[model samples]
Target: MSNSTPQKFEFQTEIKQLLDIVIHSLYTEKEIFVRELVSNASDALEKLRHTQLTEKEVFDDNLTLEINVTTDDKAKTITIQDFGVGMTREELVENLGTIAHSGSKAFLQALGESGAKNSNLIGQFGVGFYSAFMVAKSVKVYTHSWRKDAPGHMWSSDGSGTYEIEEAEGQRRGAKIVIELKDDCADFAQDWKIKEILERYSAFVSFPINLNGKRINTVQALWLRNKNEVKDEEYTEFYKFQAHAFDEPRLRLHFSADAPLAINALLFVPKENTEKLGFSRLEPSVSLYCRKVLIDAKPKDILPEWLRFLKGVVDSEDLPLNISRETMQDKSLLEKLNKVITKRFLKFLEEEAKNRAEGYTEFYKEFGVFLKEGAALDFTHKDQLVKLLRFESSLTEKGKTTSLADYVSRMGADQKEIFYLVGPNRASIESGPYLEGFKARNLEVLFCYETVDEYVMNNVREFDGKKLTAADHADVKLADLPKPEGALKDEDVTTLTKWLKDTLGERVSEVKPSDRLVDSPVIALNADKFMSPHMRRIMKAMNKDAETPLRVNLEINPRHAVIKRLFETHTAQPEKAKLVAEQLLDNALISAGLLDDATAMVARLNKLLESV
Candidate 1:
């Protein structure tokens, strides 16, 4: 591009293919064109910033390095202009009109030689300039190089196939991009609409972005900035903007890592879990960025699915994006990123739990379900996630929480298994006979109340070398203890056990003396030991026609006072004893969630009361 004449050239084969992808399928959202152009502008400003540092004879270094955007609905055009490192006529032709040789390569080479690994370079691939065609019918680039003698040029392109270059007379340093909007994308020429897209996507760009001569992107890239320089109010405002959340963030993690990969990230946990409130499940909100430019505003692969509750930004220069797939390669490196960030967050939780118990408790009450989900499903960080889980247990007061570590610390020397009982609540489990033996032995048991607790427990399986077991399982053999005074004798126990097995028949898998019962007269255990409390509830809820009637092992504490009384009464009044046996069995069936026949139990109780 020279002042003497103008030359038009055809695109290269690779440029044509790249243009097809960029215009058709490279970006999922058309609004991304704005982000790409703004990013390119920021890169130009950054290049000027570096050029001033090394070169003494810099031209127009006084111009403020900012991106100014202007939109006009009447004209159906939008203009994004920067004031740093404008290109010369030949430079414009090479950088915009064609992709033969871009200063971007030289810019990258110069910055890389400076030993500044993260020197932000824009237009590395030369495809960002053409993205304007996604929403524009034609585009014009006006620029003057840092060299004072070099002439400014205007490169115009419809981006259909070819572009033309000509010299321009009056131009400041840096570049000005004017977009002639397409008919379908005419709305972008409106100030309000373009401002909205700028605020949503490029709000945190380092450079000042002004739309219609007014500043729009005012927020700085907090992720890349020093944490000590940031304020709580700033973090809160950022969280609100990034997450589209009105409430303050419950927790936040600001971190930077130079090893493994050069990474800088600021993550937030919202004050509430919308999904818990019966809202629609949240899509991933944490965005991915390189330097200050957003690459993916809703990246699905940056974090695990269970971490959708977290919101913020993750920016890394080391992340090599597969331009074709828009996904990252080197999964192991991604895992490393996942591990480093997750570990830092988990460590933050441990600190919060220790130093700020009340606040952490509130956060746990709202967002704890997600941690449990990760612990149960994400094996990569399961161990770390498990430490963050908290639950109410038999040993804890109401609303108090105990972690697996705390439970393990309190376990008796002889106890080799961690005990947990799944039920509606503490009262339900207490009312049932499951807690009797643990209570007698002064052992603690975790109370799982949520429906997903079963799945969590199964996936976890074990923690700290102790196997997790259900307190009410049939196979759980309690330690032998001395018999109580009012218990049935040897002969009476044998006869009663025989009579119970015969009377209950198929309903009773095996009637025997109870090892788990200390006060309760009888306890029923599932004959199909595989069916846990959670499993039974699932089966009952899913398939109404399931023919598998629950078979339970009926066990009676021979030494209990109720057993002694029942033994004497059976011989004295066989009819009353039969009714009592049926009532006891019904109680166990109800506890196991298998009792469909409540009508008989009521009638039997009425008959017994009348006789009394």
Candidate 2:
């Protein structure tokens, strides 16, 4: 009994289940074992760094605080060593052998709750040290405590349900994990393989990381750096390295928040939108970090879906991470982070739109569709997003665009609604009869070109207290223009309207003399307040046999020559007048994009030609 022998210990039930899950399924990528172990070593070094300020007569005080990785492909082994606060035999039994005695969890909670303003806190789960078993056939950890009188010890495990601990000599002041790689997992022992994994997940570790005697994490954590001191080239390099992007960023917002939650974020808008170039939809790229250590490279709910195009890093010391640190634990805290960052980014866009109008116009040409999607779908930021929307209008030039705020500023005091018209292009919208009324009264109308514009406007509803009204909507009522000379008399106009209604019957909801029209003979507006021409087109696109029967109000321009002649022809020759009336209505229907079959209109035109 006097002779020293290794003492064996059995893992708790929870520890066994956790070990199996971590080795097999907890982490999707096997290479993360390196990251997890490196992170643990970094945390141990950080604790020693903090402990030195308070304690005197520490063990191995002269040891450098850095991590060293020595990979041996011949022996199929990877060894990670750190010179920090090591563990005692009793400490090892409690931390490594017990399920709930996690030093990282207690340390991180203290760091967060204390608000000590240190960025070295890394691991959250106490089980991160066990992640080495994922690729290790056998693992040995040699550690020496900081207390000068404590003896060195070695803990060895095959990860087959039992572990053994015994005294060891010549151990360093901190922990050294020696992993014997399995046959299939031998690649982890290669120099290039471990280096790549280190750069991807642990590049931002507060402590220096060396792989096979070569320094790997040379890039600084720029998000934590002060903006005034950070150079543009530094940000560019960080963006390229962090986002894996080649081109320079189009826009960048580096900000920190403490109110709703403590957060430091550096977000970038890339020069090109890959989705616009017909690439697959982008996944989230804003990596989530805690104290410079990578947590999740692509967190789904870290930001809103609309901000998925953004690339950069978001670090929050306040995060209440789960045991794996792979997924967030508090969803409400995550939502708060999302709202704060999204609002800040939207504010950045608003500034860009105002301060650099030309540059923003170029950006809008490429990425504005995303903003429109958010405006319609994200209710929390809809108003701010709506304000950022730019569109060509009746008053704007061919390529120029105006914002809703700008449109409202140009509105007359008598104007009560913000008017917009949806069409294929500016040419089609300007040439349409619906624009004639607005043009005559010197009123401007926004020109919407995309099919989604209708949906966006319908969902946005209003902006800045002014209702967003489609100019072609059936409910629109324009102010009366002065009556022109040689126009049809009041009685004649009334008689023509009644005759047209009677002849058109159910095809027309009601016929009326135009108070808004100036030169156009007729313009059709949808009678169903809910359905616009764009809505009808959307319905037809969804279902081929969808019934889009026309139900519209027909307005006749009393001053137009065609209508004056039609009134005279109505009484002189009722038979011919009916054909002309039907043809005129069909022309208006064609303009509204509601004419289903052109065969009837072609036949009617031929009959009228015969009469001529």
Best by lDDT: 2
Q: For every candidate structure, what is the RMSD over all alpha carbons to the true structure, in angstroms?
A: 12.9, 11.8
Structure candidate 1, residue pairs in collision: 86-174, 487-559
lDDT of model 2 at residue 41? 87
TM-score of 1: 0.67
Candidate 1 lDDT over 1-612, as tens digits, reads 356566676765555655665566554457767877887787677667656755688777688878999988999999999998888766665666554753333433343344333222123333557678778888888888887777788787777778777788878888899999999889998888888888766776678898877888765788888999999987886776455444688889999989887889999987777566544466777877766655666667778888888889888887654321245556676677677777777888899988998888999899888888998999988998888888898889998998899999998899999989888887888788888888888889999888888789889999999988888778887787776676667888899999888877887889998878876778888767567646876887798777656768899988777778778888799999888888888877787666766887899999989988
* Tens-digit per-residue lDDT, 178-269, candidate 2: 99999999998889998888876776666888888889996478898889998898788677655545468998999998888889999999
Cand. 2 Cα-lDDT: 0.83
- TM-scores for every candidate against the unseen true structure: 0.67, 0.68
Candidate 2 residue runs with Cα over 4 Å from true position: 1-212, 321-327
